[model samples]
Target: MMGGPSENPELWAFLESLHCGEFLSGTVTAIERFGVFVALDDGPDHPVFPGVGFISFAELSWQRFEAASDVVQVGQRVSCEFLQFDTWNLEARLSLRATQPDPFQVFADGAAVGQKLHGRVTKLAPFGAFVQVVDGIEGLVHLRELAWTPVETPSDAVQVGDEVTVVVTEIDRERRRLALSRRKGSSEHR
Candidate 1:
């Protein structure tokens, strides 16, 4: 199988010139369960594709959506941040979400420790439950913080979808993480 250098020399040069985080404008060529394809306004003809830019489902948006079409449509114009050169697929790995505002950053900017907020438990893990404190922003409610009493499992404290009151115990903005506590009170109550 051909593996080393790109068979399409022109495409290789174009890809190399593009750097990560560079903005590219394109028309949405196709949308599927996996990703959305874009026909870049720049670049040489793709011998086999109508488009040469790809945005995986995870890179489509910061907000949860039912499908790729929910964020973009065929023939729709879009601006994406270049992520990497996909040698395997000979496509530009791009992110639509990177070009948009991050809800986590915005929330962290205004949030503080010990503040209380109502959130819904969206997922359960062996260690804790992930709660959506705001749209597109979820934080971990550690097993130890599930309650004041000792808890063996996350389910024992709160099941998924439970509306619970939690305290913002920590906010690590550099790591983009929000540590939450499901316990009734802050250290003041202890």
Candidate 2:
């Protein structure tokens, strides 16, 4: 059974009536260029679901994800927020992004420029390692920012799951971006 319906017909009926807000524990049936397909356990039948749910790409996560396959696989189960449902089309919009706090927001609202944060390496790119400040939120530790010495690639200094301290050098909220350095400071050195 889906998370929305726990065998209580009354609760299900009530939930079905007002189809806005978050929905949790949905099943992922497909991953496509347009979006991820999730069959809502609590979603209403055709003609009523259209206006109630929506999933925007921006609201999908706090991390930098290029492809859905990296985090979500076909038939894999995931928790998502029901943003809107198109009842006319019998379609729903869901977002994994809505399920967590934006990392950029956390850095912007609290961590001052140059404040140090401990993060775990989640992914390594040619330029840097993606570090998680918290679940679903990540900032990039660029290769140039890994240490005082030159690093050809990010993997030299840290491997996935390695925990390291990083300083917040810059934040671009509009872009949903963060720049971090591993070097220690009063200077917040790179």
Best-fitting candidate, scored by lDDT: 1
Question: What tens digits encode model 1's per-residue C-alpha lDDT throughout 93-183?
Answer: 9999999988888998889998898899999999999999998888999999997887899999888889988989999888888999877
Task: Summarize candidate 2's per-residue lDDT along 29-70 as a digit string, tens digits.
Answer: 666676666545564432322222334556566666798777
lDDT, model 1, position 102? 85
TM-scores vs. true structure, each candidate:
0.83, 0.53
List ranges where model 2 is wrong by over 4 Å: 1-44, 47-103, 184-190
Evaluate all candidate structures by whole-model CA lDDT and list the values in order: 0.86, 0.67
